[model samples]
Target: MYTEENTARLLPDVAVHAQPHLVGELDWVGMDGIEVPVRFDAGDGDVQRASARVGAFVNLRRPDKRGIHMSRLYLQVEQALSTQTLSTATLRDLLRGFLDSHKDLSDRACLSIRFEHLVRRPALRSANSGWRSYPVTIEASMIGEELLLEFGTEIVYSSTCPASAALSRQLIQDQFAKDFDAGKAVEHAAVLAWLGSEKGIVATPHAQRSVARLRVRPAEGAAFNLIDLIDVTEQALGTPVQTAVKREDEQAFALANGGNLMFCEDAARRIQKALDADKALSDFHIRVEHQESLHPHDAVAYASKGVEGGYAGKGCA
Candidate 1:
């Protein structure tokens, strides 16, 4: 099955032929959902490897050309992404390499990589910790000499309904008034015993697991530190979901939720304010959704940096 004559034979390439099936330039033509390996620095002195789904595309500018070389794009992605640490500069080079392979047929190139980034999270007030996964997507596009980049991530937290909290407080106040007389001096031990009883706290506020989806455009020449972003987001929200918890940690989490009662609108505004104060991010879009425990429907809110020619908060895309 192997011979010198077979090796010398030419392989047919149909993509090189000029044909006129439909004579119009297409916006983008390439591949999506390509399986690839991505390596990146986690900023903790270790390079993490992630299984990613990659999308590579280049504009089809030549009307008469049958199709661009697709295998070239795949090979380049497999080669560069598997070995190199992912960064803005790396993505810029990869996009430029796409255009270089299709010299005459394409002028603009774009790429998208989606993966789950894992991080170790400690308990609220315990020594225990566990791994948590965050969904992340990085997008890059290059046209001529200019490159545009954006990254999106999702954070899960706990949200307690503010209105429900107020109603519960009112019920507790009414119960306290019924138990103690205003004109009489109440003993401290009796009050503590009543507060510890089940009938004393009549109602509890409703809380639900909520998610915050964010897209950000980093400032030029800034290091793309995802952990920093996550830290800031969790700090602003104040009630990040826990991984491992002891009794004390659970109590601490309850205290945090009690202190940080929020509506979906409140969560969005908090994130917006925090992001605005971060100089590393030039523009950002925030979308928060509270999966309501009381109602079947979810409550949501959206916000964006009000910068001209930036994210308009129109859609999550």
Candidate 2:
């Protein structure tokens, strides 16, 4: 049955109301990419609310344009915020409500929570301390008889290239050895001055602020602790942020950084190696983003458990 008059007609001061027209249950429903500030730790009265962009994507399929109610998704997220400590467990409830929200209209649902995780950091070379933010994303889906949980985390650090350092070191040794062969004892300060100056340098390996991110599915369901995963991620990446750093800490950090000099490809390989060794990670995807200081663009490397397109190390290329 098709009627053009019914589609176009709108009442002029007429009291008439009808529910939305539905062909069938939806494949997915609910809102997505909605931004909200989430507060956890129900015990504390003065707990700070962490900012999280929270929303669900439920499975809905409707032949007609008008399908699931849009307001339901907003309400579910609001409900989550008003009551509940937002852990992996709570996200499942929000998804179940998402499906139940539509009743028979939806059979499956998906949800994603995106947030900027903040932690205090002390300056690398100074006493100043401030908060640094890392992008974090968590997503879950209800499909058929199984529920899937996925977690994503990112950490920022710096990388320095070691290959370039080795070549420069060799050049100085050769130059001094030749001078010594001619019965001339070259002053050590002269070698230092030449190498320290830009003239004697061919190309110094540059390090930049880097971001390491990982994605994984939890096998233990909602009870899984994402904090441990976060720690593992930071440890795998090598240069983690420091909260409280005195001069000694700063010196230690500098020593650590110099020792852990890595290229973008090296960082990726290092993470891949770590992932291969870790028992907790069954399936994972890791990406390293190096924000180059020498160049305006970033250098990146990606890796997976199966080693598909993942630059394991600089030797990989």
- Report the number of the highest-lDDT candidate: 1
Separately for all candidates shown, the number of backbone clashes (residues 3 or more apart, or on different chains) is: 0, 15
TM-score, cand. 2:
0.71
Model 1 misses residue 112 by how many Å? 0.5
Which pairs of residues collide in model 1? none
**Alpha-carbon error at 172 in model 2, in Å?**
3.8
Candidate 1 weakest lDDT stretch, 10 residues: 2-11
Model 1, runs deviating above 4 Å: 1-9, 181-185
Q: Rate the local accuracy (lDDT) of all candidates.
A: 0.92, 0.67
In model 2, the runs with Cα more than 4 Å from the true position are 1-29, 40-48, 120-130, 174-204, 221-226, 241-250, 277-279, 294-297, 307-317
lDDT of 2 by residue, 122-182 (tens): 5656677876665667777876646777777777776776775677667756664654555
Top candidate, metric TM-score: 1
Q: Write the per-residue lDDT of candidate 1 for residues 1-317, one digit (tens) a residue.
A: 65888753666778767776667789999999999999976556577899999999999999889899999999999999999999988999999999999999999999999998899999988899999998889999999989999988999999999999999989999999988999999999999999999767899999999999999999998766788889999999999999998999999999999999999999999999999999999999998999999999999999999898988746654
TM-score, every prediction: 0.94, 0.71
